[model samples]
Target chain A: MIKVQEEDFDVGQEIKNLTQENHAIGGVASFLGLVRDIASNEEISAMTLEHYPGMTEKMLAEIEAEANRRWELDASLIIHRYGRMEPGEQIVLVITCSKHRKAAFESCEFLMDYLKTKAPFWKLEETSEGGKWVDARDSDDTAASRWIET
Target chain B: MKILYFAWLRTTIGKSTEEITPPETVKTVSDLLDWMPSLGENYSSALEKRDLLRIAINQEYADPEHVIKPDDEVALFPPVTGG
Candidate 1:
């Protein structure tokens, strides 16, 4: 599953739904990324993330498909929230289920690395100082590159 | 011809995408960037880092020397940052 929207999601509820149909699954790995409260030391009020409408969905689906191809995952879920969102909001969620713990763990991490580097999302944070655009970090690219060595 | 600006490039351009007929000799992303004088100073300034900008032809990422066809879609975006 791939979703990009403005609404919040329930992490526990989503995890349950993703793993419910497969009773044979022995492991599930999940990740939740919350919007940070700090923006240049100013209190962050909200953030509005803009994405290439059709392209964002397409790119994420391709990334997920790649992950599935590389690992033995039975199912995967990716949810990303866009638009103006306040602090404490859930910005992203990832879930992976497999027959074993290694598959679940590795797939979840692999998907996250791809999402961090390949997903097309522009993040803008609204802080007490004003709205500021975010930049792509070299560390993120490095994180993704690490997986290539495996 | 279609042109797409993504991520910070879109912010600098103040628009997402635009359609226009290419001028004579417009064949590469570099050529298009050189001729985008009407997109505003910020666009010209933000696009300074040609090496860092990952471009695409249609839906696939392309090289700087990639040939652009009349009906092709071109996208310009920085390295993606998300988790």
Candidate 2:
């Protein structure tokens, strides 16, 4: 499952729901991303996330499908929030469930790496000086690229 | 075709969406980017480094050589910076 919204999400509730009623699931691995108070040398007061509505969800679903194909997984979930958010807020969540720990761990990391690049979302950081659009880092590209089949 | 811009591209272009019909010569995404500068100064400035821009044809990431059709939804933006 995938969700893009403007509201905050509960990490505990989300995990419980994902693992419930599935006796086949032996382990669940999750990753949660949070907004930081600083960027480079600037002090970030807030950030706003923007996304292509129809396109964001569609791409996310495709990414989930790809993870499933590559791993032995029972279920997976991705939730990303958009719009203005202050520092220390939750920004994204990824959970992968499988019968064992290895698949869950690997797939969770893979999902995050792909999400960082493939998702059609942008973030603008607001600082005391002014607001600026964040640039996509080469490190992020390299992280995602490593997952590519060679 | 329906062309859309997002984030800084939308702000720089001063609009989010537009409808345009390109001539037969504008057959690919790169061709459309080159032709866009002819529209006005905003197009030229916003599209200063065409190679830095990322495009999507019908909401999927597309390459410069991707074909364009009159009924497609073409979107342009900077490289994604999401997590």
Candidate 3:
């Protein structure tokens, strides 16, 4: 499942909904991203997330499909939020379920790594000085590169 | 065709979307990039550094060599920073 929305989500409820009827699923791994109060020594008051509407969903679905192809996953969920959000607010979520812990854990990480680099969302931090767009980290590209088949 | 911009590109270009008809010589994504700057100063400034921009055709990532059709929807923006 995939969701791109501006509204906040309930993590526990989402997990329950995803794993509700899955008896074969023995393990579940999830990650949640939150807005931070600081960036580059500056105090951030809010963050405005921007994204290409149609492309965001398309790329997310493609990422999810790749994960399913690479692992023996039973279910997965990706929920990414856009628009303005305050510090400490949840920004994204990734959950992967499988019959074993290894697949669940690894796929969960893969989902997040790919999403960070491939998804179309961007973040702009609002500070005392002014609003600044967050730069794409080289480390994120490196992290996503690790998943590429050599 | 419809052209879209996002993030700083949108802010810099001063518009979210626009419609344009390019010449026949603009056959690929790279060609389109080269032609866009002629639109105005904002287009030139926003797209001055081609490497910093990413492109998508009809909502899917497109290579610079990707062929473009007259009806295609092309989008340009910066690298993603989402999880």
- Tens digits of lDDT, candidate 3, B1-83: 99999989999999999999999999999999999999999999999878889999999989999999999999999999876
**For residues A1-150, could you state the per-residue lDDT of candidate 2 as single tens digits?**
999999999999998898887889999999999999989978999999999999999999999999999999998999999999999999999999999999999999999999989899999999988889999899998988989988
Mark the 10 consecutive residues where model 2 chain B has the least summed lDDT: B45-54
Evaluate residue A114 in candidate 1 and report its C-alpha lDDT on the 0 to 100 scale. 81
Backbone clashes in model 2, listed as residue pairs? none
Better of 1 and 2 by TM-score: 2
What is candidate 1's lDDT per residue for A103-142, written digit by digit as tens?
Answer: 8899888888888888877788887666777888887878
Q: Tens digits of per-residue lDDT for model 1 on B6-50?
A: 767877778888887768787877787777765669777767886
Q: How many clashing pairs per prediction, in order?
A: 0, 0, 0
How does the DockQ of candidate 1 come out?
A: 0.67
Q: Write the per-residue lDDT of candidate 3 for residues A53-137, one digit (tens) a residue.
A: 9899999999999999999999999999999999999999999999999999999999999999999999999999899999999
Greater lDDT among 1 and 2 belongs to: 2
Query: Considering every candidate listed, which one attains the maximal DockQ?
Result: 3
**lDDT measured at residue A127 in model 3 versus the true structure, 0 to 100:** 97
Worst 10 residues of 1 chain A by lDDT: A39-48
Q: State each model's TM-score restricted to chain B.
A: 0.84, 0.96, 0.96
Off by over 4 Å in 3: none
Which ranges in model 2 have alpha carbons more than 4 Å from their true place? none
Which prediction has more favorable lDDT, 2 or 3?
A: 3
